[model samples]
Target: MEQRPGKREERKVTESGHRRTAVAESGSPATGARIAGLGAYRPQTVVSNEQAAADAGVAPEWIAQRVGIHERRRATGSETVVGMAVEAAREALDAAGKDANDVDVVILATCSLPTAMPNGAARVAAGLGCRAAAGFDLNAACAGFNHALAVADGLVRSAVARNVLVVGAERMTDWVSAHDRDTGPIFADGAAAALVVPAIRPGIFPVAWGGDGERADLIRIRADTGRMEMAGREVFAWAVTALTPVIRAACERAGFEPGELKGFVPHQANLRIVKALGAAVGAAGSVTATDVTHTGNTCGASVPLALHALRQRGELTAGDPVLLLGFGAGLSYAAQVVLSP
Candidate 1:
C-alpha cells in the first residue's frame, strides 16, 4: 500500500534536546442496555460542497462523483477539540436523562488532539464537571470506539465503574492536506459518546479484533509521510478478505449467524468498504447505515456517530441485533456482535 496524508507533526524541545517519536496504539467497552440516549456534535461551520472542493484542489463534481460527499463539517478556529467533545458528551448525557455527576469514567479516543499536553480527555472531564474521576485516551485509529467499548466493558465487567462515558472524538480535518484529493473528501470532524454499563443476560457479546502493523503505512499522516496515503484499491480488496471473516467469526462466537443481524454498522470510511463487507458476509438486505457519505470519515468517531445518525433517522429499532465494525490506522480492525435495546 502507498502512503498519502499530510500532518503537522507535533514537535517539542526536550531538556536533553533529543527529539522523541510519539506514536500511539490504543483504546472501547459494552453493556446489554439500550443506548439509553444518543447524541453527537459536528462543527457548526459547514464546508459547502463547492468550498471543500476548492480547498482540496479538486472540483465539486469530483468529490460528489467519486465519494458521494457534498459537504463536511470543519471545526472553527475557536472550536477546541475538547470543547467539541464536551458538547457532544453533554448532548448524549442530556438525551439519556443523565448528567456529568452520573458519569463514572471517561475515555477519550482520538488520533489527533487539541493539544499534546492535556490529552483532551481531562479537559472534557473538566468541562462536563466530572469531579474525582480518571480520564484517559485510546488511539486504535478508526477502530477506537469499538476498542473503547472493550475497556468500558472491563470497567463494568470488573465492577469498577457503573456508568462509563466512552467518547470517540477527532479533528481529522486539521490533519488533512487541502490538495490531497484522496483524503480531502474523506476526512471530517465530529464526536460521539456512549454511556456503557454491563449488559443484561446474553447482552454484550465478544468482539473479534486484529491488527497488521505491516500495513501501518497504508493510511497515515506525518512528516515525510505524504498526506493520506492509500492503496484505495488494496484496502477495498483487504476489506473483502479481512472484514467478512472477522464479522462472521464474531457472529459464530456470539452464537448467531450473520444472516440474523438486523443492522450492520461498519465504520463509514467509504461506500466501497461497507458494501464490500456486506457482500462478503451475505448481509444483502440488512440495513447498512452510513453518514460518511456526507460527513466523510471522522476517524475514531466514525462508529458512534454513525449509530447516532441511525437512531436519529429511525433506522434503529428495539430488539435489533447490530454488528459494529471498524478498520483504520495501526492496521487495526474490530467487530462486535451487539444486541440492541
Candidate 2:
C-alpha cells in the first residue's frame, strides 16, 4: 500500500511555536483535476417502509407518498463512521489504481460524528495506512460532499496536493429521534468516497456555492437535546425554488447547457425535492439519480452515494458531463459540473 517511486513527501509546518502536518501547496496552477474513482458503502441492516411507518405511527403508504423511500440502511453496532469511510475509500483507491500512501491529503465531509475532539478524517487516513497524509474534516451538512469536491479541485489546481481523497460519511441515525416522524424514517447512514488527481484536461468545473445563514434554524441539531429537527415544508419550498439558480450558475461556469448533461446527481434528501430540482433545471435529457428511493436521506453522503450508484447502473460514463447539486442543513448549497469518471 505504499506510493509509487518518486513521490514527494507531505508537508509539515511550524507556526506560532506549534508544529503540524499540512497539505503541500504551491503558487503555480496545475493543468487540472478530475475524479479518478468513486465508491460507496451502505449499512447491512435494511429498514422497510412498514417497519419505519410502524415506528413513526404512520401508514406505509403515507411514508411512501411523502418521502418516496421504500427502505433504507441502518448501521449495526459493528459498522461505524470511520470503518465505512475506510471501506469506501479503499474501493475508490483500487478503482483509481492507487495505493493508500499515494494520497497526500484526506478530506472527510460529515456532520454526525458522535464526538468532536479528534476529527474523523485523520482516523480514516490512519485506518487506510496513509501515515504521511494530511487529514481534515468538513461540515456542510447535505452539501458536504460537493463542497469537499470543490475544495479538492481548488487544491489540485493551486498545487496544494497531487492526490486528494474526499470522503462523505454520515451516521445520521444518531442525531435523529425515533419518535419524530419528520426525521425518524428520513435519515439513514452510509459513506461514499472519490479520488481526485491531476489531469491534463479539466475533469471538474468551477463550483458555485452560497448560504443563507439567516435561515439556519430551518434544519438544526438542538444543542441541548442533541436531536435533529426540521421545518420540512419550508425547507422543501426553499429547495425547489431557490436551488435552480445555483444549478444554472454551475452549468454556466462549466460552459454547458442543461440539455447536454449526461446525468443529474443531487443530494438524495427525498424524491420530491429531487424531481423538482431536476425539472427546474430542465434536465430532461439527463438521467436523474433517484437513489433516495432505496438509500433514503443520507445527508452529507447523499451526493457521492447517488453518483456511485449512477455509475454502477451505467447511467453515466467517462467524459460525460454531469451536474451535481447539494443543498441542506446550514441553509447551505453548492453546485458543480464534472466529467463522469
- Each candidate's number of clashing pairs is 20, 0
C-alpha local distance difference test of each model? 0.74, 0.90
Best by TM-score: 2
Instruction: Tell me which residue pairs clash in candidate 2.
Output: none
- Model 2 agreement with the true structure over 120-228: per-residue lDDT tens digits: 9999999999867889999999999999999999888776677899999999999998668999989999999999987767889999999999999999999999999
Instruction: Rate residue 308 of model 1 by lDDT.
Output: 83
Off by over 4 Å in 2: 1-28
Cα RMSD to the true fold for all candidates? 10.9, 3.9
Q: Give the winner by lDDT.
A: 2
